[model samples]
Target: MSINKFIKASIQEEDQEPSAPSPQAESFSDFDRAYHSMLCAGCSCLCDDISYYMKEGHVTRTLNLCEVGWKRLCAVSAEDRVPPPSPSLLSDTVNQAARLLQAHPPVLVLGADNADEAAIRTSFELAGTFRGISLPWAYPGIRRFYERAKRFGWATGLLDEVRDRAESVIFWRADPLVTHHRHLSRYSLFARGRLTERGNLDRNLAAVASHETVIEPLCQQFFQLSTDQDSALIEALAHPGGGGGLDHRDLPALARALQGSSYVALFVDPEKVTYEALDAMFRWSAKLNTEGRKRMVILPLWDAGPNIEGFCRVSLEKNATPWGGPFAKASAGTQPEDTSWEDLAGTVGSVILISSGVDASPGNVLPKGLSEKPRVVIDPFKRTPALKDQVVIPTALPGLESDGIFFRADGLPFDVHGIEVWRNHGYPTVRDVLADLMSEGR
Candidate 1:
């Protein structure tokens, strides 16, 4: 896609910044009733029903957000604010970045999952322009799923379809209550849809993991398998009669449920299961469709970040390849070794990270050796520079300070508008900054 085409068609120039209140409407009473509805870009579960109160061009309060979503919105008013740099300094940083791009070969444009659609597209463009590598910091299992999807296709449906038609829902090491608090209430078991008029009453829920979770009480059956035992459990499910350690009594019942359900939705947490295990589960689910002609599908529960799915979609559209690995080569060769984030950082001469509001709690971390290298981090919250020699460009946080498009967990794109403005910081979105860099680089 042309840069100008995207900017002109998708983004409105005025929407890049906060709109000052009209003189006639700038009353104290207006502040009290200045409620705005916007999308939350916290997790992959980008809830579009967020309500916030804008006071004097700033977001003062928010409602209808869970703890995870609330924290993301609250980043706008973080106490440790990094003051915006001067114009010359900004120019210098961008120039340095451009020079770095020009000098460095195979520069890794990392962190696409954390970015919005515009930024993701820009990253791929930059990668193509400079012949750099673009990879998402996603789980191995997620990456494998993408490859498998390309190789042998997948049976999937939208979250709304799950609500309306799924008679049975199985969660394998996926705890929606923690990872996505509103998932259960809004789209799954408890949600009342067209076919599932009675909500939880009409749906049969099952959980598979090493231990029980908050949803265990609602599950009709819980298949307990210790860590690294997913293979064993899957084998048990495949052949009910050849029961391994899994209780013989439960295997038959679980097998019966899998076969009986006309419409089943299987949710898997990539963080919890290995790539092989997940692949096995998906193949088995596919077999159900092939043999029994059952309506069974696999739904990934982990949201890599906002627009991670968008990155994958765009990558496929542009190059007919999946995301999360090295960028495509001119001539196809042996597959590259799967490099860890730490390993990639050490090998690459430079890295460009566009982590605006990305929260990495459990696994992602930058090694000190990698942090010691030259890098560019475009963030709005003035997060401390991770690298020793890095240009930290304070950019606007999408879904809050600026308007942009992001993809949901189910691989659907939606436009997110800027609701409140920050008068203190002249934060620009990743799109604008990248566009500027592109212009300057050329």
Candidate 2:
């Protein structure tokens, strides 16, 4: 079915569900009332202006949610949802998981990218307790970029800042329309901001990608180049008059556009380019700023789940590193290192998979040996063809069925309240489950 049809059907289905008075509902004359400022856990954008019209406990209608957010809400009642395990069974499973971690010297806690701030912190604590390692299921390129930023300072600003003051914006192999559905309307291109009072008209927009994208037509400049040409193109832009040995006709014009603007924001998806290309992009932006030519910043653009930033932040605070460690304890002061899928498969002794709504599944990308390791899966939905000898614990969907703190793509924190009561579903939050394991260990 088409996306629109599917969304329409999902909305219709939600509207048809019977409603009952919820204990949490506020006193209202009307049966249906709208709750505003609800955060959407669809992607890293975390659009916080969502409004849900609730009839008693059920969400009868919604406002400000994009197709991706609508699908996320639909998933709360998806037919394939895993039935909640009984409390006794849950206790037993937690005990078993604790025992497994205790036996495995270095437990690999994966999938923090999709978890809430509290759960992510708890995951690190759990890892520290068991002399384990915690890492987000993010692209290697992103990890590399973060590492590079520590060595050579990164020039970045918040998305709100980009929306307010940016005179020129370039989408460098990043397509927000597809990944972050509301990004253009809410934070970039079309949003009316302080200095950009005329919105798109007042700002210059450019896009660079390997293939055609939906955003290309909206951009004033679009560079469609081969995957290998990104480094050369960036080099050309970094040194405008030098040509940098590239023959792109638009290179001069693009450089001129950037140089002419007072404030420039370069949004890039690290996954779309190699480490060298990403580094060059950052350096180019830095050079532009240092030379006093323009106020330039390179903002990373990737769907690294909802709270990858939260995980990195927590890791930095607790481990003195953003994304690597089998530290014996929290705040061990270990230098951060990037962990690849191959390294994980070969090094980690055991696994604790925190499968939140995002696609945290290793799928076919991970080595077979990683799957063979003793594993514990905490997820809201049931896995097809369940793994052998692995414990699967059902959990509440973050930002939808549970209340917690989540960070946006720009490192801004949002206190997300659950739109639906989680207890009604008999599932615990990821934090609760991890806390249980920690208690079991004690």
Candidate 3:
């Protein structure tokens, strides 16, 4: 297919720091099938128009897939997708997986933004099983927004809602086109939606981000921003002049646009927005008194890790934390600090890795130094950076192999699974394996 078609069919994905094997020669055989339309929620692109080609639990070819999607599909394994099956000790591996939870009191499970729903559920099950903290590693900009949202319960809508009914859509620190590929085609620029049957110049797309980006022709306005989801505008709003800070040259224009917008929708990843900025937005939204023509919606451009939201919902419903891993919430005295993989070095005990998605091989996130302790990997591809594990359990990639639902960036529910593969129930979901491990009671 042409690159444009491939791009359209692509699923936008964030960078997964792990290293893994190259696409397999025998990855897809004769038995697998292809799936279309379903999107991967690993990133904000939320490209729903995607296609996958698979063969017998493996992906052979892909259409309309992004780099991340192709990598994710290619990473699937049909057979026992685990580590090297070390020492003939399944029991020990299981025990270690559970014990890691038990020992790491108030475990803070991170990096679930790119994971599928099944994996997310498994993580939550583990958390509940162990009672730990599970925080989905979404964009840091939205942290303030999420925090305020948890308290005041802000209003929200979907991408389509903005494209259809909203007069304005503010994409803060995010580019859906480059990352999402089909977002413009499906919802924003050239596409059609509920109120916009013949989408052309009906809705406005405002990009507030760092660096010069490509959607030049379609955007109504552009605001140069920091790559690190900055909230200088909010600070400016609070302290308009007592100011000795960054200059927001076009901020006045942005605020004017918002004030003039009859129906406004802010599409942002809460991780990028600051507490003050988000609070200001919230206050502004409340004052707008959205009733009919003057409506506002705030869509948190969320990206689910394997099971981040799924696990979070389950954790809340079940009142359980994700893992017993070290976290600030559960720890009595010590707090879990954000340490890069480089700093983790030799402190890591037995490693239990689950190559969650197509983003990258989890090895990149592991410390460069070896732990010497036995390693356990859960994935289908035998060759990858996570390859050093003493045991390899080939686990099936969930979306194509099994069926389940995952939430979108706006917390709206969507299905992640499709008939992309032809698989018998022999290969179980990661949740089942973790469930068995948790059952053994570490």
Look at candidate 3 and tell me the lDDT of residue 393: 48
lDDT of 3: 0.53
Q: Which segments of candidate 3 are over 4 A away from where they belong?
A: 1-63, 77-108, 112-119, 128-131, 139-143, 198-200, 213-218, 226-260, 290-293, 303-307, 319-329, 333-353, 366-377, 380-392, 418-421
TM-score per prediction, in order, is 0.82, 0.86, 0.70
Ranking by TM-score: 2, 1, 3
Instruction: Name the candidate, 2 or 3, with the larger TM-score value.
Output: 2
Model 2, 1-442: lDDT tens digits are: 5534543453443333223234355365444667788888778888878777777666666766776677667767777777777999899989988888777757778887777899999988887776677877663655677876876678899999989988889988889878887787677877889999978777888899988996776777788998788889889888877855888767777888877888888888776787778778778777777888678888888656678878878878986766644332322443233444655566667788877554335444345777788777888654534666577788888888888888888888988888655447878889999999888876
Off by over 4 Å in 2: 1-31, 103-105, 326-339, 356-367, 382-384, 420-423
Write down the RMSD of all candidates, one decimal each.
Answer: 9.5, 5.8, 7.1
True lDDT of residue 147, candidate 2: 70
lDDT of each: 0.68, 0.75, 0.53
Instruction: Compute the lDDT of residue 120 as modeled in candidate 1.
Output: 79
Taking the tens digit of each residue's C-alpha lDDT, what string does model 1 give over 1-442?
Answer: 5533432432232122233333465455655545546687766777777766665655544555666666666677777656666778778878887777667555667676677787878877776666666666663555677666656668898988989988888888987766776677567777799999988777878888777676666577787776577877777776666744566445677778766678888888775777678767777777777886668788887745667777777777766655644433311343433545555555567667666354531113555555555666777654664444566677777777777788877878888876645433576667767776667667
Which residue runs of candidate 1 sit more than 4 Å off their true CA positions?
Answer: 1-31, 34-37, 58-61, 100-104, 210-220, 239-245, 248-253, 324-337, 356-364, 367-369, 420-425
Top lDDT prediction, candidate number: 2
* TM-score preference between candidates 1 and 2, better one: 2
True-vs-predicted CA distance for residue 207, candidate 2, Å:
2.1
Error of 3 at 126 (Å): 2.3
